[model samples]
Target: MIRFGVIGTNWITEQFIQAALESEEFALSAVYSRTEERAKDFAAKYDIPNLYTDLESMAASDQVDAVYIASPNSFHAKQTIVFLNHGKHVLCEKPIASNAAETKAMIAASQMNNVLLMEALKSTLMPNFRAVVDNLHKIGTVRRYFASYCQYSSRYDAFKQGNILNAFNPAYSNGSLMDLGIYCLYPLVTLFGKPNSVQAAGVLLSSGVDGEGSMVMSYKDMDAVIQHSKISNSYLPAEIQGENGTIVIDKINQPGSVRIHYKDGSVEDITVPQVKPSMHYEVKEFIELMKSGRVESTVNSHANSLAAMEVIDETRRQIGLVFAADLK
Candidate 1:
């Protein structure tokens, strides 16, 4: 069985551990945390066989065949390099790095070590995501796209009071774009490839972080409007309008179903039942890849991660959203 270790025992880590337990092909063996209490609690709660206080020790241990990193965006690059240098396959959480340059270095480390490295872009591995991509031709001659991910931050009240949590801290190499906009950017790049141009605008919090933003990606014949927020909720569905029909995704980040609205007034309703929660899709996909001796999933390949980063980096550039940590 493929043994897994994870860095950062946060909410997302717990969710992923549960999904790993549900899959018979893999085991959650080890975990790491910056705090002793959190690390021990997470290990016991999940019944993980081992826990480490230091990432270097975890990388050296034979306790895991691969490592899942759910650390903050700022730590993704360094933590990924540690696992890759140790000859362990790595499944890191998204924004693969703080920027394109960091991403490039991480990719080079994986290549030099001759190990598999992939971003945990769970949305790109789902049935509903594929449902939309598979019907691309049927939808025909796309004209416009709209995608948004907005949820009131659990720490927004603190943020407003001049108290900054890790999620809201720009020092953590995170913001709405890294956390939410990636959902839209992933599909946009995967389904549409690179765009001809990108223009963006956003409201920066007092902390100099993006509280919410809207970006327009211009293509030759089609345009995609993307939105992400950390302070409010979005009421609109993410959909694309083509010359022939419109494809609607209920939740672009975690889609449960899809539907097609034809120009002729006919509708096609597609159902994608959630199995082991929506996060199960990528967990299972990773297990299968390890078992089959495959390095990457064709659906969410290395190229896909690179492409998504390309859009994210450029979009940030246009908005002048520079992070100091990104400067080497």
Candidate 2:
């Protein structure tokens, strides 16, 4: 079994741990939090033996052969580099790092250490996502791709009450685009590669972060539009328009249901049933790469992560969204 260490005690981290354990290829050996109490509390639920309050100690520990990092956006690069330098494989949660430059450094560290480093982008690895890609030829001559993921943040109420959480805080290197819009961008880049140019606009909160945003990525013969927000909800399904038909994706992030609407008034349901606890796919892939002695995933390759981050950097620039990490 591949021994795993987890950083962060948030809901997403909990989901990842559940998924990793469910895969049965991994054993949860360590948990790390900034505070001992928090680490103890988190580890208690999983019966995890090793609790660490220091990242360096956890990095140097023999308890873990790999780490799953779900820390805040700003901490992803530094934390991942520490683990990489210590020769631990890392499966970092996405938007790989705060910006393209940080992502490059993280990839460099992985290369220098010859350890497995994969971005935990669950969407791109889902069976249903592969189904979409495999069936792309049914819809010939693609012209436009539109995707939107806008769920009003549960923490928005707290923010409105004068509590600025990490979701809306620039110091954490987070906002609507980095948090939600990436769902759209990653898939787009995975399917079509990087676009030629990007045009973006967004609503920035007083905390110096975007609340909602839209980006239009221009390609040679097609344009992809993505809308993301943390202040509103959208029930619209994402669609890829082509001359012959349109591919409709139910959830841009999870892609539970995918269909095609053809011009001849015929419809096809093409979704491959996803594995339960969607994060499981990423964990399985991570372990497979580690066992195969590969340092990067062919699906979530370094080039793909860097391309996506470059798009995010351009989008932030267009919207005038700057994070303290960018200044540093």
Q: Which stretches of candidate 2 lie over 4 Å from their true place?
A: none
Tens digit of per-residue lDDT, candidate 1, span 1-328: 8899989877898888777777777788998999889889988888888999988999999988999999988889899999989988889898788887788878888788877787888887888888888786778899999999998888988887878998778788788888999988888887888788888888877776788898998999989999999899887789989999999898889878799999999999875666666677888887777677666677667778887888888877777677766676
lDDT (CA) per prediction? 0.84, 0.94
Superposition error at 262 for model 1 (Å):
0.4
TM-score of each: 0.96, 0.98
Worst 10 residues of 2 by lDDT: 16-25
lDDT tens digits by residue: candidate 2, 1-328: 9999999999999899878877767999999999999999888989999999988999999989999999999999999999999999999998789999999999999999999999999999988899999999999999999999999999888999999999999999999999999999999998999999999999999899999999988999999999999999999999999999999999999999999999999999998976578999999999999999999998899999999999999999988999999988
Clashes of 2: 0
RMSD of 2: 0.8
- Runs of candidate 1 exceeding 4 Å displacement: none
Which TM-score value belongs to model 1? 0.96
lDDT of 2 at 291: 95
